[model samples]
Target: MGLFEDLSRFLETRLDEFLKANPHLELWGLEDQLRGQEQDAIRLLGDLKRREKQLEDSILATAQDIQRWHSRIQQAQAANRIDLVKAAQEREATLLRQGNQYWGQLKGVKDQIMQTRTLQKDIHDRRRELKAKIAETQAQRTAQRTTTSWDTGWAKTSFDGFGRDPMDPLEESFQRWETEQELEELKRTMGK
Candidate 1:
């Protein structure tokens, strides 16, 4: 167990360092987290809806049972059966209480459904925002890479006009001939 914990800690530390080193990965991680949260909220909403339906069914069944017991109570009274009347009235009261409890549960489930829906929406909004940021970050990184490459290319190719002359062999020959002609003209002028 100690070894496992140490390994887990090491892995976590490495992951943290890796994520810090790559910020774009962190944005993607956030987006994944938001997606997971949205999925959880959707699942909760489904469960809450199921619970609400069950509570509604329970409330309806309890109401019917209450009505049936109420009818029995009236019938017992009409028949002048006091003991049965009391029992039927108690049953009816119990059913009413049960129905109220179901209603309360139904209300709570409905509230939870609303809250889960809001949570889902919030998660979706965060994911959208993160996606936009990720897109913007990608664009900026692309532009930065392009500019860096351009600068590197220029740096590698630049001769700064003072390094080596780029003239062809023929151009060099012509330049040499022109210099000789100028020297000859200067020599002739000096002799005269």
Candidate 2:
């Protein structure tokens, strides 16, 4: 068990380092976790509903038995049979206690279902937020076309790789302006 714990801790440390290095992948990881939580909450909600139904049935059965015994107690009273009346009253009280226990269990299951539903809703919201962040990350990566030196295309217009004019003045002006815009965008992203 000690060795297994060591291995688990080692793996968790490695995973954390990996996520820190690739921050964009962290969004995907969080979304995946939320999806699993959503599924788990849904499954648990189903189980709780089934249990609630069973408890309701038990309470109903016990209530009916309690009522039947109550009738017997009244009948014994009218017949002046004190012994039977006493026994029927005891049986009715026992059934009432059982019914109350079932009611308590039913209330607990209902509370769990409510909590699980809230958890499911929270996970769903987190997933939506993470998906939006992932989409923004993908768009940012796509927009960052140049990896070096901020892409000053003015030099390119004056001299191509072979020291010849690459394009006319009109085109050169447009390319230089476009390159500056891209550089500014990259700077803003880096600041964040």
Among the numbered candidates, top lDDT falls to 2
Q: TM-scores across all candidates?
A: 0.75, 0.69
C-alpha lDDT values of all predictions: 0.85, 0.86
Could you tell me the TM-score of candidate 2? 0.69
Q: Give the lDDT of residue 99 in candidate 2.
A: 91
Q: Residue 24 CA error for candidate 2 (Å)? A: 2.1
**Model 1, C-alpha of 2: deviation from truth (Å):** 4.1
Clashing pairs in 2: none
Clashing pairs in 1: none
The candidate 2 region of ten consecutive residues with least summed lDDT is 148-157
Q: For residues 7-31, what per-residue lDDT tens digits would candidate 2 score against the true structure?
A: 9999999999998987789988888
The lDDT of model 1 is: 0.85
